[model samples]
Target: MTSAEPGAEPLALSGVLTAAEADDTARAIAGEQRADGAIPWFAGHHLDPWDHVEAAMALDTAGRHEQAAAAYDWLARHQNPDGSWYAAYAEGDATRPTDLGRESNFCAYPAVGVLHHYLATGDEAFRRRMWPVVHAAVEFTLGLQQEGGQLGWRRDPDGTPVTDALLTGSSSVYQSLRCALALADLAATPQPDWELALGRLGHAVRHHPERFLDKSRYSMDWYYPVLGGVLRGSAARARLAGGWDDFVIPDLGVRCVRTNPWVTGGESAELALALWTMGLERRAVEVLRSIGHLRAEGGLYWTGYVYADEAVWPAELTTWTAGSLLLAVAALTGDTATRAVFGGAGLPRGLEADCCA
Candidate 1:
């Protein structure tokens, strides 16, 4: 795969990962990619659309463009007739479905990956090739959006719509929608409905948390609106401050849930991304550094560490964990595309909704 420019600055975090270490981490993620380009949580683990795209974006962050493009090509080739992917796939044979559900966020995430790749490499052919895939996927996801603008989590295997929405999932969808619109602009095909949907979704995320499930105990719910670009300015700052003590443990990392004693690499890195979006660079770097314990010998990070039990839970090294950290580091190290995507500076804000209504 193509690499970054030889004279570029390294994605190194002081007192944490060096340039070599970062390269090793990227390679560790690439190693988990299947021959067909699917990246499972770990070797032999089930592949989920959301995590798969997350890992692919990381490859692009590390200048693994060819590998990342292959990953997107795999998604395009295997997409369902309805433009959505199954929730989980058998790692051994990704063409075989493991979980038959279709998550809206999972279906919508390819837009983010595609847009990131396009921004990173300026690949016009790649953008055109994936346009229809992204279009259909966004349509499938928006079909599940409730009247309040929050999207239902998923469709059952049998095509049943479960109308309950998730704050974190829909927040993620909000971010993906913005990315899709960015791609749409590049393709010269505007999606006005998507813009309206974006406004409603943003309102649901910012003003109507009651519309979503009470997942306040989860750290993602605490930070995803900020990370997902729906919440910002003083409101974003206030949200992070409110939840910092509950979720972040000093010298550890972010916990997956409020009551849990385990700190997960994925969530921690994602929090760093949120912090970086807020221009809190020092906090973001510190958050990234705190999770150094989860970095295993092979450069892949453990899924999480259970500080209460003094053990690494699940005994697994995940590509997404490393992927998330790489993305955060990429943003921190002045990767313009990564910064633009996560920072919400270049992406459209969509139509604004009347929150009072």
Candidate 2:
């Protein structure tokens, strides 16, 4: 599907991207979107709830309002009775789930997307329609929150909880809970319990590394707390500084894993977002620009480049990589709605105390 006519003004990122290029990237993501609204990583790839929502939010940043709404509608239709979605669906087809596990972070992500759509379009009716969906999904996710405030990662197919928590996943959920609370406030249906949950979750993300599994080797684990808005000010700065040398490759973007030579577009874009969250605008722009080599001809991005091998390891382009890049650019360019979501100034910070203590 051709997303927009040729002559539209570009959402240019100064020297990094042009208007036409931005629209092409957004259209590329839209083109990969299935008839039922699910957006896989690529055509014929499995669709996961978390990345699906990310792609939808990117569409919103690009002013693809109708497509974004359709993505959310797809979620509403496919959500399990208990509010979670299967971790992966075959080729965006719900009937052919590739993974039966239900992940807490993945289940919680639609709240971010729904709220982003509402912020971008001022669609009160859409927000209202999605209210219950967000509510139920949050409830299902928080049901797995450990007593220490960190959230259990997922539930197996048998419905058994995987009690161990993941730093990256919990950090993402921190942002999602805040977004859900924001939605709750807007809908005039305040959730006091969510506020309390947010507090505990924040405490875990901010101070309790021992409670989460050790995945510091991955870039997401290193920076998600900041990107998710649970870490800020001096703490966020220190975290980024500590990991910079290990994960970042100066002009080539960020490595997906500390021990690997692969630089992924998604991780690089997200790190840019984390830097932007800490008010490092110039550095964020540089980081975004560093991955320019991954930009595919049609506006999508290759998944990752192996610098050691001097090759793009993943031949396929991914919607989430493009989505992440668009959101980062939108945030950096001062797009009001994107800034409101990622900038964390407008979103409510539920009681911020150590509820677990």
Candidate 3:
């Protein structure tokens, strides 16, 4: 491709992460990995299963399938008997600490990671191993669902539920449920509860946001529904369009909070991924331009801005921040260079009419 007319370079880090840049970022994140295979946000913090899974997926996108699977195996080794992962694990191979115990979302996310690993390798054995985990996790998670159909955010090791459902948290559970159902379908397991759970969640997401006890000021609450395929058709299209004025800056990408001046790498990058999944390629490019200010040296990304001030409030460069950007980039461009980092897979299956019913 020729040079831009005058100022055609990518305007944001969302898209500005060149294949080489992405490679470096991916490697840097990988370097932080512990001997036990958990990837923490930075060097010192404990590793949560979700971040490990995201980083693993990033590895897949970067074409490091073996490394990615090892991450998954790390998760598999720590997999709870009830089909869940603990809320957090200490970094490295030493004795793991479970101060936070198990989290619902953490437990559910691995279903996606395992399914992706299977897609990349066509390993039925992995599928066989994960199939029961996926089912038990979904079943256990569904028990945390409230009467309003929102999911509880966490649980004690004894299976006692913690906080009420959160919009973003449940959105993820919704995604996991669909992935679980897809696995069940492939294995011919026929999970009626899985279907029922997804259907209930789709309704909560589409019809009753208030039911979710929503503290959804973040951009994650903005596009993840669409990205998760929980929203579609005219209603989905409208939600995507409606958020533009409040959350997006066509030139700068997305705001981290709906009312805040802060724009963050993780939020913007995730928004791009959501848009790309929705087939909004040009808009995804816009998000990419907004985050271009992100630096290449930091294997991590700025968490968010203080406002239009351009100063990063959260000075930390999180692994998931970079991971979100990579996943978004791969989906937006279908660029083969990034494709090798992950499997050449389509979006996970969305819930059908009676997914939860």
TM-score of each: 0.97, 0.97, 0.85
Off by over 4 Å in 3: 1-15, 92-101, 335-357
Residue 147, model 1: Cα distance from true site in angstroms? 0.6
- RMSD per candidate (Å) reads 1.4, 1.5, 6.1
lDDT of 1 by residue, 1-357 (tens): 535444445678796689999888988898899888899999988899999999998888878888899899999999999999999999925568999999999999999999999998899999999999999999999999999989999999989999999999999999999999999998999999999999999988889988999999999999999999999999999999999999999989999999999999999999999999999999999999999999999799999999999999989999999999999999988897788788878898889856435
User: Residue 299 of model 1: what lDDT?
Assistant: 95
Candidate 2 per-residue lDDT over residues 60-159, each given as its tens digit: 8887888899899999999999999999999999999999999999999999999999988889899999999999999999999999999999999999
What is the alpha-carbon lDDT for the whole of candidate 2?
A: 0.92
Mark the regions of model 1 whose C-alpha exceeds 4 Å error after superposition: 1-9
lDDT of each: 0.91, 0.92, 0.69
Per-residue lDDT of model 3, residues 18-95, tens digit only: 656766777777777776677787788777878888877776666666677678777667666777777776663325
Q: What residue pairs clash in candidate 1, if any at all?
A: none
C-alpha RMSD of candidate 1: 1.4
| True-structure lDDT of candidate 3 | 0.69
